[model samples]
Target: MVGIGYRKDFAEEFSENTLNPAFIEVAPENWINVGGYYKKMFDKILEKYPLFVHGLSLSVGSPEGIDVAFVKQVKQFLDETKAVEYSEHLSFSKCENAHLFDLLPIPFTEDAVKNVSKNIRQVQDILERKIAIEIVSYYTPIAPEISEIDFINSIVSEADCNLLLDVNNVYVNGFNHQYNPKEFIPKLDLSKVKYIHMAGHTKVASDLIIDTHGENIIDPVYDLFQFTMELMQRDVPILLERDFNIPELEVLQHEMDRLQIIKTNALKQHKHAIIS
Candidate 1:
């Protein structure tokens, strides 16, 4: 399935019935205990599309450990909304009980593996449902004891959780770290991936690319997405994440249509290869 991220910036377009996606994703922290107009708009959107929640908290890799109270609230919200899926960044965003509002990269070490696995189990137990964790983009890379790919494989296996594969983040990290994005996709446990994210990035310097979900997705990221689907051998839901530079409703719809075409073509290629 294909979808768009629900943002209030497109509230008018949604009311006019211009945007049509199979599903929509939103950050639950923004909606829980909310009231009035936005809440009403969200309820209307829910009627037409399945709701998928992506969280900003949970801080699965933080030293502060899991926040039981926040997760309990999330469980309540998910049950109330009957959300189809929930996801969070694999990176940590909290330190010393204060929200950093940034997706900071976790150190690739054996100790971190155990820490993250325990945190994820706590969340899953409280929610009583598995949650997907996205491989986030980061500008800095600290002294890592293990490789990024190995670190991810270990966590997902130990935690027994799924993944929200962010194609754009892979492209960005590949560029910044001087690795081949094409070669990198195959190393991951693709079977663990439950959802996908595609977005745009900005080239601030000749060598650095920032994961800015502001511009239209470039051709390379799209290429990687279609390539990833071929490996999966099945359809998985993907969402076009345009969190900034809010474009016109038609523009977002056009992107969704292109994704549908690519998704369809990739699956056909896979089936044709099998039959051949």
Candidate 2:
């Protein structure tokens, strides 16, 4: 299946049914108190498509610790919306109890692992269901006591949470940090991947890439997503994100159609392999 993030700009597209997204993801914060036109559209959307809730401000790695009150509010939103799934980045967005306004990398240390794991557990306890954590992209490395993949494995293992794999992040991080993106995917526990996110990025320099979901999914990122589908050998619902510089609805849906084709072809190949 293929999906797209809910944005006000796409409201017309949603109303027209010109683009059929298998599901729609929205940040609960965006609709919590919204009124008027958007609220009416949101209600229609809920009645039309399966809603996947993605969060922007969980700040799972915050050293300030998990916000119990905020989590309760999130739970309330989820319950009200009847959201099927919830996901947040596996990075911190606050320090010293103030919002940093960006998802910052957590230090690759055992202490950091413990911090995030405990936080994840608390969130799961409140939500009463497993929440997916997306492997976030960061421009720089923090104090490294372990490899990035190892650190991620540690936290998920300890916390017993699902993963929201982002193919674009893997590609950008591998280019920026100088590693093989293909090799990185195999290291992850893909069985725990509840869904996948694919997006476009900015190539600021020949050697650096920024995970900017502001453009179309470039060929290389599309290739990475295809490779990921083949590697996982299972059909995972994929989402296309265009947070800014979003193109026309038809163009975006075309990208989604390409993703659907890749998934179908990859799974068929896997089945052929099994038959052979």
Candidate 3:
């Protein structure tokens, strides 16, 4: 399936122009405290396209614990949307008094893994739905004890949940960390991947890549998408994230068209290779 990750305000615009069904990524805070605003917005989108809940502040990797208040808000949204899947980033964004407002990496020690796993279990239980974690893009200051893939695998295995598998994040991390994306993608547990995220990023310096989902999906990311599609060996739902640089609806459609073409070509190549 194909979907677009969008904010709530654009529901009407999305309904009018989108030919294929799209997914809505509702931030709970935006809808929860606005006196039924979220409900009204959600109803409008559900009328047009499929909706899915993607949270930004769940802080699943935090040491404190799953935020029950946040979990309730997400559950309410899921109930309203009837979304098949709920997703959040694996990185932590909050602590007692600090809000990073960005995906922060966790130290990949056994203790950190255990704490995160426990928190994830609590979140799943509270939401009463299966949750998938996204692999976030980081700009170093990372703990040197563990590799990125190992850290992700450990959390998934311990939490016993699925992975969102952001392809752009993989490319970003690969470039920043000085590793090959090809070598990294195959190492993860493919079975745990539930949803795939694709977006555009910006190149700052010669070595720095930022996960800015504000532009068209570039060629290198498209190549990685092809590699991921081959690795998965199935037709999985890919969602394009465009949080910033909000362009004309036509531009978004163009990206979707490119993705469809890539998907088709990948399948054809796989079929031909098997036959040969």
Candidate 4:
């Protein structure tokens, strides 16, 4: 299954198109803060396609206690949409009553893992649905006390929540942190992965990978996606994220077509392997 993240302007076109993505990821802030006008538009889109909520402002990894009001509103929105799943980044977006507007990394230590797990569990308890956390891309390196994969695995295991594996983030972190992305994938508990996220990143200095989500899906990430599909051996739902430099509908459609081609070829290869 494959889907795309949508903003308000493209809601009608996406709804009208018969593409029928596996699911659409909605930003809670956009859907709620916009006047009732946008909500009406969202309702119409919901009528046409399945919706999933992916929040950017939750700041779940923040040390501050959860934002009760925001969580309540998000829950209401999720209930109204009957979203297939809800997800937020594993990094913090807020600190000291200010929005950093970036996904900041945390040290990979037992304390951080415990704190994150507690937050995740609280979110699940409030929503009455299991939630998934996405591993984010980090520009700066943190000399974590533990490895990134182990930290993520511990948090998910403790929180009893699913994982939303972001392939682009993995690639970016691998290049920036000098680790092998392929090695990290198999280390993660596959049972906890409910969905996968793929997106484009910017190339910096011809070596660094910046997760800008503004370019086309590159080859290395595509290759990793193929490997993941084969290893998972299941039709996991995939979401293509485009957050900057909004392209024309036709352009996005082409990307979707490319994704479909990759998915088909990868599945065929996996099948052949099984037969052999």
**Alpha-carbon lDDT, every model:** 0.90, 0.91, 0.81, 0.83
lDDT of 2 by residue, 1-276 (tens): 999998998787768887889999998878876689889988988898998999888899999788888889889999988888999999998888998778899999999999999999999999999999999998998989899999999888999999999999998999999999999999999999999999999989988888889988889888988889899998888998989997888998999999999999999999999999
- Runs of candidate 2 with Cα error greater than 4 angstroms are none
The deviation in Å at residue 215 for candidate 2 is 0.9
lDDT string, candidate 1, 3-65, tens digits: 989999887678778988899999989988898998998898888889999999889999879
Candidate 1 vs 3: which has more TM-score: 1
Error of 4 at 58 (Å): 1.4
- Model 3: lowest-lDDT 10 consecutive positions: 18-27
lDDT by residue for model 3 (1-276), tens? 668876654556775665354555555656655657546766776777766667888888787877787788778877866777888888889987466777888776777878888888889899887798999898874555776777889989999988998999999999998999999999999999998888999999999999998788899999999999887777777888888877877787788778878877888888888999
Tell me each candidate's TM-score.
0.98, 0.98, 0.92, 0.92
Error of 3 at 121 (Å): 0.9
By TM-score rank, best first, the candidates go: 1, 2, 4, 3
lDDT of 1: 0.90
Off by over 4 Å in 3: 8-12, 35-42, 272-276
Higher-scoring candidate on lDDT, 3 or 4: 4
Candidate 3 local lDDT, residue 133: 90
Q: Any runs in candidate 4 off by more than 4 Å, and if so which? A: 15-20
Across 146-178, the per-residue lDDT of candidate 4 in tens digits comes to 888889999989999989999889988899878
